[model samples]
Target: MSEQLKQQFTKRIVELQKRIDSIHHDFANGRHADWSEQAGERENDEVLNALESEAKIEIQQLSNAILRIDNDTYGYCGTCGEAINEQRLAVQPSATKCIKCAD
Candidate 1:
């Protein structure tokens, strides 16, 4: 089960990295000549920047979860030291805290 979770995390990490690379590509090489159109593009770029930041953070969290799995502490809550609920883990395998402590 832990191995399965590790594989799942690994897959998500790859997906996020791809998305980040695509975002960087967009940022580096595309723009309209007209100032007005460029302003609109800048707005879209800001949203992409936020998404890129979010993906980076999630990647780090998933990386941490992988470490926990290796250490045999994958299912335990980081804050309360309780076994994380199965349902919660199903929905969020990289979670570091149980529902109680998370709340």
Candidate 2:
């Protein structure tokens, strides 16, 4: 990858790391307690829990993307070993497959 693109990806990865850290901190500190309490209905709690779990999973994916960037593998399709499109990377930094391979 070009140095400029690598720098850009590094910056984005750092931003994602920060967001993941914030989410973890909030969850650890019980920041979502109010939401859990205000759920009022069992269904609401269930929905909220599911959403939180999804967010955690996404954060882990972002973290893995950052690791890929550090390892100089970021922008390469894991399935086909092809360069991932810059546009697609901009839209989904954690993506691990090229368009064709993804499809």
Candidate 3:
């Protein structure tokens, strides 16, 4: 992989990590509501929970991508051992498999 692409992916992963940290902080600081607001609070909490879960998964993926870069394995399909297309990497920097192997 080009140094430029690796740098971009690294920057993206760092940004994602920051976002995850913010979500964690928000979730931790969430407040309990009064009885009258409990129902709405529950619904909002559910949505926040879902968002947190998604962010956690993305953080994991980005972490793995960073590891791959460190190992000199970035941009290679994990399943097929082929060079992953630049377009695919641009769209999903954490992709482990090429489009064919992914299918």
User: Which candidate leads in TM-score?
Assistant: 1
**Residue 65 Cα positional deviation in candidate 1, in Å, after optimal superposition:** 0.5
Pick out the ten consecutive residues of candidate 3 with the lowest summed lDDT: 1-10
List candidate 3 stretches off by more than 4 Å: 1-10, 28-33
Candidate 2 lDDT over 60-92, as tens digits, reads 777677678778898899999999998998888
Candidate 2, residue 66: lDDT: 68
In angstroms, the error of model 1 at 43 is: 0.7
Across 2-67, the per-residue lDDT of candidate 3 in tens digits comes to: 566667766876787777787778667756667767777678778877877887788788778878
User: Candidate 2, which ten residues in sequence have the lowest lDDT sum?
Assistant: 23-32
- Deviation of model 2 at 1, angstroms: 10
lDDT score of model 3?
Answer: 0.81
Name the best candidate (by lDDT).
1
Q: Report how far off residue 77 is in candidate 2 (Å).
A: 0.3
- Looking at model 2, the pairs that clash are none
What's the TM-score of each model vs. the native? Answer: 0.93, 0.62, 0.77
lDDT of each: 0.94, 0.72, 0.81
Q: Could you give the C-alpha RMSD of every candidate to the true structure, in order shown?
A: 1.0, 5.1, 2.4
lDDT of 1 by residue, 1-103 (tens): 8888889899999999999999999988889899999999999999999999999999998999999999998999989899999999889878889999998
